[model samples]
Target: MRGEAGLPPVDMSVKVGPLALPSPVLVGSGTFGFGEEYAPYCDLARLGAIVTKAVTLRPREGNPGPRIWETAAGMLNAIGLQNPGLERFLAEKLPPLVAAGHVVIVNIAGHDVEEYVKLAGALDAAKGVAAIEVNVSCPNVSRGGIEFGRDPAVLGELVRAVRGATRLPLIVKLSPNVSDIVPLAAAAMEAGADALSLINTLLGMAIDARQRRPRLANVTGGLSGPAIKPVALRMVWQVWQALRPPIIGMGGIMTGEDAAEFMLAGAAAVAVGTANFVDPTSASRVAAELEDFCRGQRINHVSELTGGLQV
Candidate 1:
């Protein structure tokens, strides 16, 4: 098919393991609500997928007031996995996105292995779910409330158990708070994760010097946005070099060039997170911009940009 200005269409389709996405640009979970909320501002179908916010077994009230604080070129959030829980999500959230023909990748979190198993099993039968993204950044109550992604063993066990519960493709979202990300990425892959999502916000804190208090009520929150882009890119490069697992790269991506940077570093797909807050149409815009980038580079397929970075 011919593209804009009589140029040949740049193939934008990508396969993150078993999941085939029409575009490489996906709106990150928690940033884009269940998918329908941004319909008026952007075309949901034009994007790769809509990764829904983290859902747990039970409803969570999230964190106290001032859960979000804006910082230099980024933002800190301790939303505490706030959601309406599984039942409501399957009933209320999933249907609308599916009805709208949006590829829905549900992000799930839990306090322990059993909860994750239960969630995976439940979602296995839920129609319209394209895949399940295991958010290992959540606390594991059985492990003294430490984040599941912090330990390679714990993350592997979690992924293994979830893998057994469902036949759906599994995407493990890794935390960037670790000392080295390669071990955790290897563990997830060995445990049967079909794809990996890297650098899920770095741990950070913002203090109010004037009030001598923390800016966020949670004291510390996940830091995201342009400030973390370099770190995210590095991690993605390291993991890809070591394991080469299908990766969904994210962190401070605000434009097409940013997405291209991640792809060059070996991300099979890129997700837009913090940028959504600034522009609800950011995801769709990024997709278009990525196509423009591909055309400008004389690339025939977007996949050609994957791991194309030179030393």
Candidate 2:
């Protein structure tokens, strides 16, 4: 398995629960659009997986003006989960992705338990959907976003409902705005989640000091990028220690070293988020860099990096 540049043969494939990824790097939902938005800039099929934007039961116009605000090391977004709904995604967006031979993971959000179940069942019949990332934590939405995610009972119920709906690999995406993430992580797993993705943006806001107003129309938005790396890493590490499920660590993953750090912190895989907005090919590049990282460390398989942290 000698890699490109004739370095030591390194294996990047990882088992994300029942899903086997060819690489440890994946594109985070929302940031990568419908998994094809960045295809013009990079090869979507090259990455381990692509998590599509938050798909809902109906179309949403998203939030009002100034949905995104740039900060020091990160950005705040209150996109409001605007999407073309399931029918449109299945009819128009999904075909090209499946045709491109890429591993597609559809991420869905809902205002209630039944919505999640319904959406899951709908995506189940899609041809190329490799998995479903349940977005229980979305700061942008008002009804069923972070509200359901913060409550262990609600989160468990939602996971269970969605689990019963689809046979696709279910990955519960957890929120970071909770007091104890361990319980929530355990709840999802106990309710029958095959995998987990952690730190789906922290609740944050930016104030326009000059105008004496909020930077974003939604006032508070989900914070992501380098600023949230430490928080994301800590949560992923805690969840991995507690649940030991296949975890996809995301939030502030911008480079290959960052992705490697997530794996070392106990993530089976890592997703590129805000970095995609900065560089469309970030995910693919991270995958390549991870291979070089393994070769440099004399590690033959990338899976060895999971929970490899000495401390």
Candidate 3:
């Protein structure tokens, strides 16, 4: 609808699975830090949603020293999903998040199918938890690692079991290390995932040639940043062509144009990750820039960018 000035007020709202968001820009888990770290940097309520770092049934110490390393165009980290366990998160972090008025989506990880179910059930009862993002694609863990995200059949079972355990919207985060991502996406949706977040992180490593040692203590870590943007867009486009579920496209989104590229490639929304390290308000910046872009292009709404790519 046009505003008082007659130009259409860009509608940035988007629905992913069952959750409705005010804007299409969300902060990726791990980077945003439960919405508290950046609360002063940007308005958390202005974002579509904030996905917290992966929380487990038990607290994790994460990986050893040198867990993060900077590369040419991106950074690699094998932080190993360090997070306060679900119980502590509920007792401490969650209340403030809700009180701060931010829409929260808890990202959960598990060592096994039963663990996933247990986490889902527990989070379902937590107040102020908007949804659950199943972190099946972390490459740093020894148990239940990327294996759960790589196998189509196994992923299906996991999703189905998680579905049975919770009533909240389920978003199965997909791994980019797979041979083909389409089948993995299909399996997740078929197993009852309400939405999907694609291209978690590409498996990569940085080495110190002179020292003959890996830059990261874990030797390898998930690669994220502008380096993976093209790969992410391709996968989002592939899944968008074959699936009807909303996708939270993420990987190397650093700017408004990058987010728009993902949207045009078929993402219902985009998540900002690595850029957060450079600027805490990257998500809000992207959203503001996106609106400016829509105005310049005469696009009535940002949602029109979704799947608007032409051959």
Clashes of 2: 0
What is the C-alpha lDDT profile of model 2 across 161-184, one tens digit per residue?
Answer: 898999999999999999999999
TM-score of each: 0.97, 0.97, 0.97
After superposing candidate 2, which stretches have Cα over 4 Å from the reference? 1-6
What is each predicted model's overall lDDT from 0 to 1? 0.89, 0.89, 0.89
Model 2 error, position 38 (Å):
0.8
Best by TM-score: 2
RMSD of 3: 1.7
| Root mean square deviation (Cα) for candidate 1 | 1.8
Tell me the deviation in Å of residue 21 in model 3: 0.8
lDDT of 1 by residue, 95-157 (tens): 988888888899988888999999999999999899999988643122212478888998889
lDDT of 3: 0.89
Q: Tens digit of lDDT per residue, candidate 3, span 1-311?
A: 32435677888888886789889999898898888889889867768888999989998989997989888799998999888898898999889988877788999999999989999999999888899999999998788558899889999999999999999999999999988999999999999999999879888999899999999999999999999999999999999998856999998888899999999999888899999998888988988888778887888878899999997
For candidate 1, the TM-score is 0.97
